[model samples]
Target: MPEEIASRRSRITPEREAELHEAVLDLLREVGYEALTMDAVAARTKSSKATLYRQWGSKPELVARALRCTKPASLREIDTGTLRGDFHRMVELSDNAQMAKDTALLRGLAHAVHASPELHQALRRLLMEPEISGLDEILRRAVERGEIAPDCPAIRFVPHMLIGAFIALPLMEDRSVDQAFLAAFMDSVVFPALGV
Candidate 1:
């Protein structure tokens, strides 16, 4: 095939790309990243393996794209005007209910990251960096508002503390982080420690 003809034929529309990405997430949720094959994704999305390979280049790339697609857009914009409020929102947003469907997906990803250096790097770049950027923006806004001191140690640890509970408690207690837990965490732990 001519280069131009091949290029034209390979061009995937944005909607199609989104559909494929959604299919990938669904497969991730169902079977997990380790078991999720490009052939399965193509079959689920009604596309071909050639199309998936053409678009994402590799399984890691496809998994990265799928993981990125599942992230809530609300994570990017969390401005509740107060540090406490922002922390609460972050906890609520990171709750187990939101992540309940992805337990297998996360486990699979954890395994993949442990086994493959390149996939680990790609996963960090694609999944973690954006979330860190969003959390940094939230913390910066809190500092600007004077809700927390510019040099507060809590500021540095807040994201990890909040997200850690979500990731840990579910495994330990087998329960979701509810509003009551969020409120108590903020009142007893976060606010008190931050001196807010």
Candidate 2:
């Protein structure tokens, strides 16, 4: 379990906490972070504001908990031996079909993170840093396997490239990351750039 989960489990019943967290996610999707209030979450979860306050302490912390709960666990560990296998696993894990359903929730999170420095820092620590570390582990393994040079520019930039592709394509063209695109990305950009 994540450290956050272990810490939070001691504070509330598991079922009740799940219900409250789900309510927060629902509200984030429907009303967005800016409009979602502790009172609304309390009413939705049939809990009191005091309960929320006693558990989460603040709106950003509650939102962070909701995001933490909702994120898919598939990307937690992916070590496929070879670089290509690892890259493919990463792409498969980041399926556009899965993400499409959560576009509203993602937008709400972006808005909230942009508006608050504290929330932004929390997001960096909770979401971005861990994912980046996972990717870096894959790259390190690739380096050990002799698939790429130790100092390869592509290895260094791979995480940003992959995430940039995800963010840019959706925001710019409003298109999903299809298999054809993934193939081309791997063939033309990723592999060659990595000197594979």
Candidate 3:
């Protein structure tokens, strides 16, 4: 087969792309990962199936890109002169209205993630890495400020612990992760574990 032409192409505006991502997340919350067909997304967004494929190549790629875009990119700007203040800001992050939909989407995608290698990698790359990296940055700052030890083992898994609390609280406690709960967790669990 001959190579396709590379120069002449159309593009989507950032605003339109964001709208498509919002549609993807909303659909994922409603129909879930396994049942979320490209056809359905095309219909929901009033977009051509060919356009989606040409943009994302696959469902996993598209979903991953959408999830990645939902996370806050300004976390590096969260320094408040103290770890407590920083964590309080982190607590406030869970207060968004879409958090409920995001939680539902995550719960629905759980089973599919295990069954689909492509989707599993996509979620890890798009959804998890940035958050983990931000948390690591926080840990590094704490170490530099002597608020926590550089070699603290808990530092490595703080994100996991936070995620565990986020997931488990909804299941075991029948409540969403919120600012107050996270503040308590930080004071009682995370800060103590860090010996801060």
Candidate 4:
């Protein structure tokens, strides 16, 4: 490695970057995307304003990077032999605290995403695509297993339904997403939608 290359690269460690990302998400949850600031994130992470600006260039870059950090570390282990089993595992993975955290961040960003194209693309790439891909994989497997027909048009909407239910839960009932709700939802909605 060249000394000049090493000198020009960032000094922040991966763990430290994760700390900053967590701070950004937490602050986004508290203050919302439109209201969130580099100053607040700096204060929360005990980082200097100059360093953040230097590293990320702008608020969108930083927040987008933070949201990317929040995605599952990898594609979730989805093998459960049955589509219902897989859906149950995916929903159970949400738990209570994580669901609330994600919901809060999403709720905060919902308004702001429409205004900022960069942020909108970031949310789509970092927050949405992975979950969508996971659902596609699950459905693909179910199709292969003959649990459902390959030509079913309803298959495409499953991911949207899963995410929609999460977003609507707070609006419909003043409550947080938990395993019990997910379990019942799988029985009532997800199963029927899958037609299995």
Candidate 5:
């Protein structure tokens, strides 16, 4: 039955899929991940709950894939001859409004992630791991360029530093994380720690 459902879903057009995914994100923003339901998604997207379940297997997977749709361009593609330049280019690519929305969504999901192992696993696999690998690649390139030392202990903490700044700025200063904030953060905090 699952295989049959999967086969049927395969025939779904990319446009339709994108529409559904966007609906899911809208719902997530409106009600948050814990309050989000397949029934609500069905109504919002004009899709069947059975189809949603069959297409994604579970709530965690459905939510993860929906969130994945909102991901920015792959970080691996960023190469600006310098790590600082790459980081700045990344800032340029970000839309401040979209970043704020994503931050709020992540804050809402953070609590639910602790209570639901399936959700945590799904997000880690479908979303987090790819970004982590991208960060790793960026750091590796920096090391190769001698911009950062190969044995820099701060290398592993790069994501933490970035995510911390993203999550902390609004809480600490009641300010949205715009490109200016990020650029300054890179210069004052991240770059100094990396010894770049």
Candidate 6:
């Protein structure tokens, strides 16, 4: 089944695939996850629903894959020689407008995630786990450099802290946090907790 899906998906050119994913994201931004349908995506992209289903299998998988495509780069690619430097670099790399848009998209998806096991599973597999693993690598590097203790209790919570900061700002301030705000969050909350 997986091989069949892969072969079927391989029929589309990369450019076409990217266009379809972008169309999905645009629809997601406009309607939120609950209202985003394969019909809508097909209509927007001038593709067939049968093709979308053949390539992606289901709505959750399609949405998860689309969201993953939007990520700038893998966190593992960042190696700044220091955890603080890497954290700040991440903030610098993120565009404020896109970040805000992504934040809103994620917020909209949160409820849908809870209701759909397939969405939760697809998101964890395609998006969340890779990022978490990359973050773990960053923390491991910090431990290796003696910047943080090897046995530090805070290491486990770093992802949560970072995610919380991003999610909290929109809820608390009614606005998305910019690079400066995230940079300060790293210095004040994350670095201090890590005792760096």
Best candidate according to lDDT = 6
Candidate ranking (TM-score, best to worst): 6, 5, 3, 2, 4, 1
TM-scores, all candidates, are 0.80, 0.84, 0.87, 0.81, 0.89, 0.92
Per-residue lDDT for 79-157 in model 3, tens only? 8767777887887766655566667778888899999999999888767876778777877887899888888888887
For model 2, residues 1-196, the per-residue Cα lDDT tens digits are 4677567557888888888888888888888878989899989988889878867778887787777776666354888789888778766665566566555467657867788898887777777788888878888888998888998866778877777766777688876566567767887888898998
- lDDT accuracy of residue 95 in candidate 6: 84
Name the 10 consecutive residues with the lowest summed lDDT in model 5.
Answer: 1-10
CA RMSD for every model?
4.6, 2.8, 3.9, 4.1, 2.8, 1.8
lDDT of 6 by residue, 37-56 (tens): 99999999988999889889
Q: Which regions of candidate 5 are displaced past 4 Å?
A: 1-9
Give the runs in model 2 whose Cα sits over 4 Å from its true position.
1-8, 13-15, 178-180
- Of 5 and 6, the candidate ahead on TM-score is 6
TM-score of 5: 0.89
Candidate topping TM-score: 6
Separately for all candidates shown, the number of backbone clashes (residues 3 or more apart, or on different chains) is: 0, 0, 0, 0, 0, 0
Candidate 4, residues 48-92, lDDT tens digits: the string is: 999888667688878978887775543456879988788777766
Model 6 CA lDDT for position 152? 84
How do the residues 1-196 of candidate 5 rate in per-residue lDDT, one tens digit apiece?
Answer: 3677669679678898899999988888889888999999999988888888867889999899889888778787888888998888888877888888887888789899999999999999988888889889988989999999999999999999988878788789866698888888888999999998
Q: Judged by lDDT against the true structure, how good is candidate 6? A: 0.91
Candidate 4 versus truth, CA RMSD in Å, comes to 4.1
What TM-score would you give candidate 2 relative to the actual structure? 0.84
In candidate 6, stretches whose alpha carbon ends up further than 4 angstroms from where it belongs are 1-5
The candidate, 3 or 4, that scores higher on lDDT is: 3
Measured on C-alpha atoms, candidate 2 has an lDDT of 0.77
Which is better, 1 or 4, measured by TM-score? 4
Q: Candidate 4 — which residues are off by over 4 angstroms?
A: 1-11, 46-57, 71-76
* Candidate 1, run of 10 with poorest lDDT: 95-104
